[model samples]
Target: MNRALFQKIIFAWFEKHGRVLPWRVKNHEDAQRMSGVRETLATYFTKAWRRDPYRVIVSELMLQQTQVDRVLPKFEHFIKRWPTVLDLSRAKLSEVMIEWQGLGYNRRARFLHEMAKRVVEKYNGVFPQTETELRTLPGIGEYTARAVLAFAYGQDIGVIDTNIKRIFARVELGVEANAIPISPKEFQSFIDFSVPKHHGDPWNQALMDFGALVCTAKSPKCDHCPAKTLCIAQRIAEEYRVKTYAEFLKTPHRNQQKKQSIPFEQTNRYFRGRIVDKLRESPIHMEELRMHMETNHGLSSRKKFGEIIESLVLDKLIYIRGSRASLD
Candidate 1:
């Protein structure tokens, strides 16, 4: 494949359609003019926006296992409340968890808090620039480390998120979707090779935007895709559509059923969220907790509730004091 040509096509599409997210840095000169600041474009983009590692850290952590749409408001609120690593490090974990409500996966909130403390205490409030140094922090994995390097440090590194992985699987390997347990090392090599030199940040961002808006997991917009002619998955999907249509003509009544989702109210996660939400307001007795659960959520299993409370306490998410339960 002509990698340069591919990069050109992707970048051209991105220039027209790249997402305007709050975390993304805007045009430096325009922003400076608007703000009436007398700083150079280099200083504004490098120092004020892209180079601010704190913003990258917070956004990347929140984006993990969460959708961008759901994260937008929470991210804005979080950054507004705790604008710096020192602010976050000094905050109570319970307060962090309270702000982290509705974003589920409460463990991430704790991890972010711990990461902030580590950055403040060990690094003296300076965010690490290298991937190796970043990996030493709590919950900093390979993907996140590389992301910080590319986005914040302007390093020519490969960032292999789920979307980028899927794009590679389809465009390079001719697969409809990436299979489970993809080999990270092999895929990383492909991405590192394909990423244009000196254009790592925009290249990675464009690929991500294309994957999210055009080449989605469930239903890709193949007709509107810029790389349709070059994409093997598009051809494969076309063939599959024709075959499926023929089969449907033969057996129109045998349509496949959609999978059913488990009820949220019946889930342990739901109850855990309820427990945390309740405690966010005030500490309550176990009896009162049970009553609220029963009355509000229609959950009547006292034994199950007790088990969940015990589990939360063990996880250090909650504290129990003389039959009263509160956030840890």
Candidate 2:
């Protein structure tokens, strides 16, 4: 597809079908400036939306390995509670962890808290606009660093997450994403070249919304996809619509094992989360925790459960003093 035409189609679809997310909301100035642009609706809508860097970091950390629907409420509550980086920096780790209930990933809360403190102390509560500076912060990885640059500062860069990689694999590489693994970094150069500097903000948002709502990872709505005409993997995706998850895994192109593993309830991560959930209510004795684990997670014996507790303490997620353990 022609790069300009691809952008045109995608940008138009975005104006029509873009998601209404709280974190994506534009500030008063952006809204006012956007409202005054009389060149063309496409020109107006194509511009990147400006956002508070604080909200962007909060939403980005909360959305990791979690669904949008799940993050929506939690993000709102968290922002209301600690409206800025300075506020979050002042909060205790234990208080942050407690507010992180139902978010599953306790470590994310810690990272967010630590990142806020660094931003407050080092940068004086202002997020650096450059990717190099942002990466030094806790929990700020490659994708996150660039995402902050693009979404928060409207930098002329693409934010390549899994959804964008899937879109690239099918639309540009002529293969279903499930047929092989897709790495966001592999296509970073292509996306950066393709991304229009003026519309970098809405452009990345459009691609993400397109992937989530239309060209999804499973059972993609190819027939209804606005980019189907340009997508090379449309027919390939349609061909596999009848296959079950097991069948997809068993296929030679899948590059995955078909055998099942232990249930999530039996995993150490699940038990760790269980222990965290218990600690959230209040501090408890080690024996009581053992009994709680036995009653809830079906662990009747220690079986390295003690090791998990010590590990959590070592990770700074919890603190241990004598027989009692609690969130650090």
Candidate 3:
């Protein structure tokens, strides 16, 4: 696709049907009554929350493989607790982990903690601005580093995540709606060239929202979709598949007959049980903690349990007073 044509299609789609999110303040009615939607989106895209690298990094990290709804509360609480990289650096590692309890993938909490320390110690409590510098930090990868630079620093570097990947795969690769391909660096280049001038941040975010709500992983509502005319997947569905959208809508999801979800057991889960077990036992020395693990408990090894205890200690769930360990 040509750059100007791509921009016209995407921007047209975004202007007419872009989902309004709470974070998008430019569209707020109080801001301006007569602003064009495209201009409002562009203003929101450029001027919105591009100052703090830590905020950008934290939000991105919290969002990793997690849905926006699940991440919102956790992200808010984290920012409230830490406020800044400096605050997070001064905080106990245990405190950070405790705050991170419900987020799952506990390793991210550890990485954030270490990243905070590194920032404070090495970077004078300020997050690195460039993508290269940010990438050198613990837990910061290419995607995350680029996200920080683009979202926080207002850099024009291209960012392509899962949502953008799905859109690009369908549009460029002529893939089926259900069979989106993985994103390649070539796709990044395509986006860099095709992205609306001076609208990289909001444009990327809009693409994400578009994929999530309209061009969904399952059962996309192509008729309502902004990119319907230009979409390869929709064209394929029309040409190759005999079923109309109305008829397709009548079909139940393939796994609809399966259980809606796996049972979420609070008590039987390993960590919850371990916390209970630790509380029941009398205060034990670190050495005694190791011995108990080896003798009575069928735990993998004392070393492993010790590491858990250490994490628990850092998280402030457990603490050692003198040589004995107990719940905090």
- Lowest lDDT block of 10, candidate 3: 259-268
Writing each residue's lDDT as its tens digit, candidate 1 over 43-142 gives 3224423546777777888899899999999987897788778999999999999999988888889989999999999999988888899999888898
Off by over 4 Å in 1: 26-49, 180-182, 236-328
Superposing all C-alpha atoms, what RMSD in Å does each candidate have to the true structure? 18.9, 17.9, 19.1
lDDT of candidate model 3 versus the reference: 0.64
TM-score for each candidate, following the candidate numbering: 0.66, 0.66, 0.63
lDDT of 3 by residue, 1-328 (tens): 3446655766676765676542343222322453354334545544554646777778778788677888777876787677678889999989989998778888888899999999999999878888789888999999998877776666776687877777776665455334433224334554565557566666677777777777665666666765666655456446646343323434453133122322333111343245447666767776776666556555555455654565456446677899887775
The local lDDT score (0 to 100) that residue 35 gets in candidate 1 is: 52
lDDT of 2 at 168: 80
Q: Where's the lowest-lDDT run of ten residues in candidate 2?
A: 253-262
Give model 2's TM-score versus the native structure. 0.66
Per lDDT, the best of the predicted structures is: 2
Each candidate: what lDDT? 0.74, 0.75, 0.64
